[model samples]
Target: MATYLITGATGGIGEAICRRLAPLHSLILVARDQAKLDALALTLGGSHHAWATDMGQDGAIDAFTARMESEQVTLDGVVLMPPQPHADDNPMPTPDVWRHLFQVSFIGPLALLKGAVARMNPDPAEGRRAKIVIISGISSAQVLSHYATANVIRTAWVGEAKTLAFALGSRGIHVNTLSLGGTLSPWYRDKLEERAQKNGISFQAQLTIETDNVPLRKYGEPAEVAIVVEGLLSQFSDHMTGLNILHDGGFTRAY
Candidate 1:
């Protein structure tokens, strides 16, 4: 069985990804909370490993990469899910905000990818398969003034993924980005509740307002997103690379 490293593995969608991939792949769960990681590893009931590290910390990513390399571990795949920002209702973007965004969204994931990709077979003739799936937000493609930091960093991250796809494709690695719409996960539940409270409306009312923006007229479920993620990580997408798939329920009319 292939081994996959998943960052932010404790979050809603992250945990969904873990559940979807657990039966087949050996997981290396990376998250900020050690207790949560331990809980998830136990729930998964597998020989999975858990690494507790905060991506926002300066040396954390470096340490993770170094440890994996020194252990001579080979990663067949990597699933990246950056931690969700807390109540990004602020219109003004600060330097600290940008720094944190870049740290979790771009820098840390990039470092991990470098290490994971290095462990993959470089010889195409060897037929050793490898995949990298990145979960980004709709802000990557659409403009959300409140999510300015995310918009900038996510776009940059997608660009880097494309570059890496080309850099690694010939060596038998595929890299892709899944730009998502609002999913009714724990992260969005908190965000929606905050927005509703701010707007002096009920949670369900706020949910309706948000879903009205989507052509599908509803929020996506975690399992729905997980299925697509599974496809990207599996052999089904062997011919695909450098693709940015928008899984936003037609919220953005960007054809």
Candidate 2:
């Protein structure tokens, strides 16, 4: 079985991905919450291991590399699923928050990939080639004023993945970004609740507006997004790289 390294494995979409792949592969879960990771590990059974560390912290990547070495872990794939809809109540967004988002969304994933590729054996006799899938938001391409940091940083990360794809293609590592539209996950519900409370609107009313706003006439489920992610991580996509595959339900009208 292939071994997978997944960051942000406790988050909404991240959790979905874990549930989908846990039974099929050996999983190394990475997240900031030890308690949550431990709980997930227990629930997923013994084939999964949890590593609690803040991927955004300075030198975090190096520390993770050391841990992998100690564990003798070799990864066949990596999934980057950082926080989405990063928002703050600050009247003006601080530089720290901006930098934090960029670090988590872009730098952290690249660091993990750097470590994974360096450790993975290139011989096809070892197993299938390595793959890296980045879970990004539709806002990365769309203009969402409230989610400025995600918009800017995710876009940059997508570009970085494409560049890395070309450079790493010869090394048997495929890199791609999975851009998602609005999906009905815990994170999405939390944002809806926040919007409702702030606007003095009912949660149902807010949800109605959001669903109606989408061309698909409904919000996507986390499982739906997971399906797309699974496809990207599968062997069928071995020949593909440097692509931004969007799962927006046709919400993005721009060509």
Q: Which RMSD values do the candidates have, in order? A: 2.2, 2.6
lDDT tens digits, residue span 1-255, model 1: 889888878888889999999998899999989999999999998789998977766588778878887878888888888665744656567888777777876777677677677776635576678899988888888787777667777788789889989988877889999998888789679888999999999999998998897888888888898899899988788899999899988998987
Off by over 4 Å in 1: 84-92, 194-205
Each model's TM-score, in the order given? 0.90, 0.89
TM-score for candidate 2, residues paired by index = 0.89
Residue-level error in angstroms, candidate 1, position 208: 2.9
| Model 2 lowest lDDT segment of ten | 83-92
Among all windows of 10 consecutive residues in model 1, the one with the lowest summed lDDT is 82-91
* Per-residue C-alpha lDDT of model 2 across residues 124-157, encoded as one tens digit per residue: 4554688889888777677766666677777887
Candidate that would win on TM-score: 1
Number of residue pairs clashing in candidate 1, backbone atoms closer than 3 angstroms, sequence gap of 3 or more or interchain: 0
- Clashes per prediction? 0, 0
* C-alpha positional error of residue 228 in candidate 2 after TM-score superposition, expressed in Å: 1.3
